[model samples]
Target: MILQSLVRLYDELSRQGKVAREGWGTAKVSHRLVLDEAGNLTGIVSARKKVLRGKKEKEIPSDMMVPLMVIRTTGVKANFLCDNSGYFLGVDKKGKPERTKECFEAARVLHHQILDGCHGAEAKAILSYFDRWHVDTARECPLIQENLEDILDGSNFLIQVGNRDATEIPEIRKAWDDYFKSAGEEGNEERGQCLITGKKDEPIAILHPKIKGVQGAQSSGANLVSFNKDKISFCSYGYDGEQGKNAPVSKEAANAYGTALNFLLADRTHAKVMGDTTVVYWSEHAKTVCQDCFLGMMGDDSGLTDKELDDILIHMKNGQSADVSGVTVSPDEPFYILGLAPNGARISVRFFLRNTFGTFIKNIAAHEERLKIVHPPWEKDWIPLWSVVKATANPHSKDSASSPLLAGSLLKAVFLDGRYPEALFQNILRRIFSDHDEPAGGGKPEMFKVSYVKAAMIKAYLLKNCGTKWEGKIQMAVNENCNDISYVLGRLFSVLENIQQSANPDINSTIKDRYFNSACATPAAVFPVLWKLANAHLGKLDQPRAVYFKKKLGLLMDKIAMPDRGTPLPHRLTLDEQGAFVLGYYQETQARYAGKKEDK
Candidate 1:
């Protein structure tokens, strides 16, 4: 299914002139080999430009459409028009003059065979240049000496005739295309029915093109569908000692899927990172509106304000078309989201989702709505997924990343409207317990421990997974009418902590720092001790403030139904009950300062 969808994408993108056609591809060229009308080596020029990468500017090579590069591994294959210094200039840091000379000769023979009969000045100049350029004397040329270091660094170069790139000439392009099409058309024994296209007697690709830009994969790139002949585990019974033949993907189908996937991975605007996985998404029918909408929903670089994003999401959820970034996008377009992870020399599929654009919008809207809660005034109205995942990490640990697999799992739950992974809730609880007592470490004190994103996630989880048990009990804010034993205990504990703070304004540590985790787990043992401490704090307050806090505490305590056997507080709370306890404390604390300006 993945390959079939990619093949269709390749066809659509090809018709839109977005991806390279067969026999052609894009290469990053760092220099250009300039030639005169007489085909003499004239000069060398940088083909790189400064572009912003993150906050820093970098000088990177220019991507040019050239003949497809050969899949080389310890081989002397040469590319047409564009290649590294060893193949084009006969000079490199390989420390093998014999091998370098072989590379240059192969390129010379290829150019002569293709462009010799071409009737264009660009073609003639290219042929003349290769004929006159001798490998032995290449280093002696003044132009080569000036740029020798950069060339020896193995950056790719393109051939330029006079003032134009040789590949841009119409006659030369036709010659290369024709030669490419007929170069390898002879009979082959590996021909079979293609698994992707189901076509009979087609040549199977011995090797698929390398996939680049996958995080943590080889910089040279990695293979998605690869089999090693040397490894018996990868060999099928009938296809021993064969690689791509084992899969039986036609050369054309392989090229189409590889090209399409590479195009999506290379695009920065539509590709995003989810933990260790690299995510790439696309629309089925040659439309970028889906990409725009998805990025906007994720709070990424979608060029849309928060209000604008909310408006589009609303329109889509209502089954209406939305004008996103001035492009009208229907809600019913087919959308695909693929997650790729690095696995040794191969890429692993973390997750793949397909749905109508409107369904995705509705799911995301539901997710956002569930995450809604009464947050601090300074927090953004919409919390991005990255922020939610980060809330579970340890701020003091050096490699404090949440589980690498959790991002994909969480995203899958959101997209499918399924139960969220239990790890998300458990990790949040662990972090809350471990980090709740620590000082803010030079940051704002109010931004400590239980963040708005964390609280909202807990509420969202309980409401979704707990079914009708927590339907009306879990709300966006503190519910005074909620009298669940664990919840009321949590609210009472927060009130006691606040009373301690009010009595002693300059106190270094409140009861929360010392007793929060214990109080949440064993409320019966801790709440009675906290009630005795609250009486002391009430005596320290003025008469008016003392009466006010006492009355509030009495009302909260009365809501907790006393048991006939013993006290109202339970001996211990369950994991789900512990989550409600945390939410109760967070929401009640927020309510205390709801209208006041919080000190940062």
Candidate 2:
């Protein structure tokens, strides 16, 4: 079903001229095989026309549509019509005469294939270039032979004829293109029912193509599906191990879906890398409604101007019903989001979510609302997936990649408005325990406080697991009236820390630096010690300030029951209570700074 939908999208995108043609792929061409109308080799000029110093290489734009990469083997599977100078022009690195000869012969075979299909003026020019060409012992081609040893292995080369690019030459481009579109259909290969299209007598794909640009996968590319005996454990009694026999997918259908998915992955505006998972999304409509706005919501859009982002934020804040660029989103249009993680050569489908565009917006909107805390003004309004995941990663690890499974589960829940992963709760708690409490180090003052993002995440996690009864308690700012013991303790901890700050402004270590984690986890054992410390801090303050804190602490103490003056504090807090503690700490700290400049 996923491949079928992707194939459908491919057809639509091709009809709109949005995706690459069947026989072509994007390439980083660095040299041109300059030729005239008669195929006379012309001077080789550098494709890197502009050079920048203090950088490894110049930044140059790559060509969009070149001949597809060859599926090379020991038998030499050379491209028929369009290829780089190395494959067609016999170019190779220095001191590799055998490789040079092998490639030159491959060029001859490629030239022969092109001639069989095309008989036109430009075709005649191509024949002239290779037919008269002979070996030069001195290695005299100005283009590739000049710097053969230094050329990048995949450095692409293209032909130019009579002041027109080879692609512009009608006969040259069409000849090979026609051959590719018809190549797999000519042979007398056994046919099977296509799993994707259910078409009878269609050839099954021997090997599905590679999916590149997936981080941590093979640089050559990874497979979306595979059935190799050595690599996979599962096998089936099929039509004698024929290609795609167990799970039949026609050659055409496989290519269609593969092509469409690769196009989406290459497009930065359409694809997003979240933690270790790659998320690709699309609308059923030909062109998405406010595509940039849609991308900004799911992925990070660093290109978006602050004003542009603000405009979209305002629209989203209004329930995504506002129009942008005069384009109103049709709420009924279906959208698909596919999350994938790379396994050894195969893709693991993390999540496949299909829903209406309106519903997607709402799910994200709900998540945003949960993250809506009274944060410091300098913090970003747009909290990307990276920041959220990074907070949970261990800071001391060499590779800080988030757990792929956990990240995928969390995102799926956000997209579906379902329950969040339990792992997220545990991971954040681990990070809090690991770093939230420590002595002042390297003579630097402790700035230990609950961050807005972590606090928001805690609220979201609790609401997800515990439901809407927490609605009024978990909010943007402090709730002074609620008397949950954990919440009260958290506020008290912050107040005590503030009193310590007031008493000794230059103190390197505070109670939070020493006792935050213990007080949060086992309040019964720590609060009695903290209350005594608070008394000492209160004594150092002036008369009016000391009186104010004494009364404030007295009232907070009244809320929490003490059978006989600290006789029976709760022994340990549950995870939900811990969340309440974190939120209470954040709200109180934020409350302290809310109206300093505002009142002025």
Candidate 3:
């Protein structure tokens, strides 16, 4: 029987394209077969190698042609007959033929049993069973035909059952049927009483099915069903009005729709759908209803439409910005809401205000959970130089000014002279002096000069505060006249005297003579008196020295004839033609001091 099976397998392989045209050599057959004594085959096997001198040459040693015939026979016997026929199919121990009638009879009996049991089973189930049996038989067999080995390696088939054309399984179809049946029954139970008018002979049911399957099952119309308990029954389909029976929305429905729209607009996480009625579609992962949708259902339309909602939702799905403009009362204000899709983009509803009453076009910033109820007004004002200076010193200040250092320099110039770059000075002055009570004419210049003088006085006071240490430098310089300190002090005092003589007309010539003679004749004589006065003031320096300097300087100023108190100092001095007077005096005093030092 084994020999017969082997011969049948060889013929089957030749019929198939799996085997080479030239028969396998003796060596190949030997590799595939192992046998027992008494000329009875006991095992089969397969191997492959390069055919050194064949038409089909160079290839992977394992790429042997499949033994299709041998595989089919083995599969049939093991899978259908349920018996081991692989042991009796090849060369014997002594390389002779092995055959037996008894073995064939046993295989025939097993085949009959399988055929009877498996005849009516589904082809898929039968194939599955056969596949299992084939695998078991192959593993148990000690040796297999070369083609059989190839066939086993090549076959990796799967089987499917039932009608291939069916769109849904039986279970799903049954579920749909059950759901629709239950829905229908519920609709019938909730049906309202028929409305009867006086002119009508018989009452008519307000809502009746218009057409069965008029719209396909997948369409919105087919998916809709309505029920009512009131005398005036209402019916409509398509939640968004894209499809289904068209019906006018009653006041109640409108309110409901408006409420839904508000809720959808308010929801931060759910992309809003605005239509006649707002809707928030739920996803598997995002199961919560949108707060905006809930608010909309409660009747709020902050200026949104169903189409806009749909557009925003579409954008949300695509991971794009879903901001829609012109929906709210203030069009410039943005209304931020959540994106519907899993994409983390936000949907914004914007309102543009038309012809607002303020100088600036107002824009209110809003988002989900936070709405700007009142928009603050914007005002324009100049920023002070001091503010700029302070801001520059503090790194934490976020001032919008471009260059704080430049601002500070400009401010300092104005503080020192009250006449800096006109534009910057005026701007900073306006900010600082806006609240001052001083008049704007001559009073303004006077006030500005006073401010400048006050700054200088503060510097002098600070130096005086240095006490004996500060006086020692001046005393030493005066005694030794080191580095021409005597000449410098004489020059400075002469400049002050000249200014006083020009400004005041009541000065005594004797006092002027004494000041000049002491300042220039012997710088030491001027230094002792000036030093004693400065030290005395420094000893009592807790008092306001700035005020003291202003008062004392005013008392000493010569009374020069002037038009009014408000006249600018520059204008007065120019009118008097004292341009070179102070400078000439300073030069002469320095020259006198220098000559006297040379003589000493």
Best by TM-score: 1
Task: Assess candidate 2 and give its TM-score to the true structure.
Answer: 0.73
Name the better of 1 and 2 by lDDT. 1
Q: Model 2 — which ten-residue stretch has the worst lDDT?
A: 230-239
For candidate 3, write residues 1-600 as lDDT tens digits.
211222233333334432232212111122222222221223333334455567667422232232112234422232121122332222122222223233333333433343333332332232333323332244344444534545343222111123221112233223323433343343333222212112222222224222111111222221112333233334334323311123322222222222333333344334322211112322111213222322332224424465654564444434454444632222122222211111112112121111221101111100110111111123112122233332222222364332422442332232222223333322332232222213357433212211221222222221233234333322211222212233244334543443344334465542234444334344444545654444444444335643554444343232222347653122222201121222223344444456557889
Model 3: residues with Cα > 4 Å off, grouped in runs: 1-175, 178-188, 192-600
lDDT of residue 16 for candidate 1: 82
Q: What TM-score against the true fold does each predicted structure earn?
A: 0.77, 0.73, 0.14
Q: Write down the lDDT of every candidate, Cα atoms only.
A: 0.86, 0.73, 0.29
lDDT of 2 by residue, 52-108 (tens): 767665656356466666776665666644465556556555556677667767777
C-alpha positional error of residue 228 in candidate 2 after TM-score superposition, expressed in Å: 0.4
TM-score: model 3 vs. ground truth: 0.14
Distance (Å) between predicted and true CA of 331, model 2?
A: 2.2
How displaced is residue 521 in candidate 1, in Å? 1.3
For model 2, state the Cα shift of residue 491 in Å.
Answer: 0.3
Alpha carbon lDDT at 216, candidate 2: 66
lDDT by residue (1-600, candidate 1, tens digit) is 889889999999987879987898889999999998888888789999899999999999988788989999988999999999998888998789999999999999999899888887778888888888889998998888887887787478999998999878889889987888678656654889999999998878888888998877888889988887654777886888788887889888988999999999888888887677788888898688778778878756677777777787888878998886677788898888888888998999999999988898788878888888998778876777777777778867787676889988998998888998999999999988987555545764545667788889999999888857788998998999898888887788888988999999999988988889999899988888898999999999999989988898989978888678877778899988999999999998898887345443
